[model samples]
Target: MQRTDVNTLGEFGLIDHLTENFVNKQQTTILGVGDDAAIIAGGDEQIVISTDMLVEGIHFDFTYTPLKHLGYKAVVVNLSDIAAMNARPEQITVSIALSNRFSVEALDELYAGIAAACKTYGVDLVGGDTTSSNKGLIISITAIGRAPAGRITRRSGAKVGDLICITGNLGAAYLGLQLLEREKAVFKDNPEMQPKMGEHAPYLLQRQLRPEARTDMVDTFAKEGIVPTSMIDISDGLASEIFHICKASGVGAIIEESGVPIHNDAQLQALEFNLDPITTALSGGEDYELLFTIDPKDTEKIRFLPDLYIAGEIVAKEDGVKLHTKGGNIHPIKAQGWNHFGE
Candidate 1:
């Protein structure tokens, strides 16, 4: 008998391998896997469901990550997936496994954050499970959203000549993580030393600890009468999400280096850390921005969209996924983004 390692398949591959044999038999099951969220038919509307798990140490560190922010973020990340499907997230179920280390007051603080997120997003907590764990805290949230049959978007709908667009700036959350790790290391070395996060700490830390889903974009799309040909939220990175869209849609993409949105603060921080700003934007994960492709005819519709960047265009698969560099260079874009199995 041979023993197989999970790392060899990677996260997505492992999922594919495990679920490859299963078949969806229900008529309501419109989508089952290989997408930001699963879709179910519901008469005139489609229900979008997405679940995410966050484990301590792996996804976050307690030294810097507040319990409240963690609770809020856990929910937001799941909602982002629903938004990627162009749906409205109306409810969520939060299940948690925790050890005896947490006190009642601590749980209160955590729930307070979750409640705040629910209030802010106009969602309901609904129901979930709470159990004891032997190790660290783990949070699993399942977001439930709905959209009209015609408005439900999928990753497989992109076509050649579609305009690739992105919401908000990239790389700031990654930089914020880097900054927190630096401070954590410094604090570990000198117990008396305070963390030096600098003046830009607020924005960077907020981006990292409490990223907002692009749910507003769904409303914008409704208002503007524009439907994306394809869409995916950027949880991994810009490059990796582009690869996902390309693979799903059977199309290639040409990303313009100059068009990728990078914040000034992130640029400064990247330079301070001896890293390329563009590389950070391309490969640094956890930004939670929306990456979508729209029909070329819809270009004028997104022109006045706040914080939207026309970063690239969909192309024939034969062209291959490549990046047009600012230095007049063309290079095949690699998915050097977050690897869940990599240590």
Candidate 2:
């Protein structure tokens, strides 16, 4: 028997391997995999469904993370996935597993965040399940959304000459996570000391603890009459996501280092940690921004849209994924983004 190490497969590789045998037989299943969400055929509009899971120690740590924020984040991440499909989120089902360490009050606090997120996004919390767990807290959320015909985008639609783009700034969330982990370590050593995060990086901390989905960007696209050729949310780092688009679309990309978005605070924080800001923006995950591609003709309209930046352009698959550095150097783009499996 060939015993293969899972880490060698990575997250996307493992998923592809596992789902290879499973075929979608139903006519209603318009999409089954290879994208951010599965699209089901609806009468007038397609229904997009996506799910995300957060394990206590792996995805998040509760020591400094508020339960309410965790609940809110759990929903937002799914909503982000839905938005990546260019769908308007409608409803969600949440399931949780926790040990006896939690109380009714704690549950309420967590639900309060979920409720707040639902209210903010105008989605309904339809159903869910709860069970006891010997391990720490676990949250699984499934979000359903709808997209009008011809408006639904997928990772495989990008073509040569399509402009690569991303929404909002990047790298702050990764810095925030680093800062939080550092603070947690400090607290472990000295109980009386508090986390020394100043007002300088409030946005960073918020980006990590309470990320918002880019549903507003979807609205902007609708208003601007722009349907992306290809789309995927920046849940993983930019480089990893770029690789996903290239592989799915059978095209290569030219991402410029100068084009990657990084906020001022994130740059400062990166310097503080002696890390490269570009590296963080490229390899750091969990920013929840939208990375997409559009026809070159739409460049004028894209410029008018707020918070969207054209980061690169699509090329022939044989050309290979390359990054044009600020110093006029070109390097092969590698998927060094978040690997959920392991290094």
Clashes of each: 0, 0
Q: Give the local distance difference test score of model 1.
A: 0.85
Question: Each model's C-alpha lDDT?
Answer: 0.85, 0.85
TM-scores, one per candidate: 0.87, 0.87
Tens digits of per-residue lDDT for model 2, 171-280: 99999999898888999999999679866469999999999999998899998889999999998899999999999999999998888889999999999999999899
lDDT of model 2 at position 231: 96
- Model 1 lDDT tens row, 224-305: 9999999999999999999999999999999999989999899889999999999999999899999999999999999987
Off by over 4 Å in 1: 1-43
Candidate 1 C-alpha error for residue 170, in Å? 0.3
Q: What's the residue-level lDDT of 307 in candidate 2?
A: 85
Candidate 2 residue pairs in backbone clash: none
lDDT, model 2: 0.85
